[model samples]
Target: MKKYFNRFPHAVRGITYATGNDFGFRTQVYLGLVVAFIVFAIYSPLSLFEFLFILLGWFLILITELQNSALEIALDQLHPELHDSIGRSKDMAAGAVLLAGLFLTIVLIALLLSRLI
Candidate 1:
């Protein structure tokens, strides 16, 4: 337990550095917060399931963004010079994040329409 607890500081430091220095990560976090606020405001009387779904969607987006940033940083450190394969890998990582965002958007829209109509 002591050994496990010792790693907490390093984990915290890594998260702090990544979120503080990464533009994409910060942007996604802000966007998620804004969306959460809008959804909660518009749908004040949310059911348990609806609220859970909203939280899940935002969590998925943030998870994907973190993964994308990690992959890009690792690739950059490994291959400072631009290469076709590296470019493809980065593109795929970005695509994954975009797909997650799109799915979240669809879910949000459905939720909003369900409430409005």
Candidate 2:
């Protein structure tokens, strides 16, 4: 248990570093919070299932952004000089983010449709 507990600070530090250094990550977090607020405000009595689905969608976006940002940061640090391959690698990471965003969009659309029905 102690060994497991030690990881939290490291995780927090990484999250803090990303929050400070990555604009896209920061924007997504803030936007997610705002969107969540709007959703709950609009639908005040949200069901547990709906709430969990929204949370999962938002977390999926964050997880992808973190993974993308970590990869880009590591690649940039290891190879500061510009190269075509590095550029492609970064693009692929960004593509992952795009795919995640699309997934969240689909989740939102599904939620909306379910509510409408």
Candidate 3:
């Protein structure tokens, strides 16, 4: 039990650090706020499945952004000098976040259309 509890502070610290320092994390949070407002104003009383789907999409975007941030930070620390492979690695991480955001956008659009139409 003590062993399991020991990890909580580290987890909290990581979240605090990311929220404070990662621009992508902050952007996602702002976007999430906008989404929440839209949902409240335009699509109240969402169906359970619809709500769950939207939550999943948001989770994917947040998690991917966190991963991309971590990767970039790690790569930068490991190799401050500009290298072709390092650049490619960073680009791939960014691409992953972009894809996740695109997917979330598609899901949000579908949900909005379902509600509006």
- Candidate 2 clashing pairs, residues 3+ apart or interchain: none
lDDT of 1 by residue, 11-116 (tens): 7887787789989888988998998888788888889998888888878877888888999999999999999999999999999889888888888899888977
Top TM-score model: 3
lDDT of 2 at 42: 75
Q: After superposition, how far is residue 8 of candidate 2 from its true place, in Å?
A: 1.7
RMSD of each: 1.5, 1.4, 1.4
Candidate 3 residue-wise lDDT, 1-117, digit = tens: 999899999978877898999988989978987986888678888889878887888888888888889999999999999999999999998898888888878888998888679
Cα RMSD of predicted structure 3: 1.4
Provide backbone clash counts, one per model. Answer: 0, 0, 0
Error of 1 at 14 (Å): 2.3
Cand. 3 Cα-lDDT: 0.86
C-alpha lDDT values of all predictions: 0.87, 0.87, 0.86
Give each model a TM-score. 0.89, 0.89, 0.90
lDDT of 3 at 10: 91
The alpha-carbon lDDT assigned to residue 57 of candidate 3 equals 80
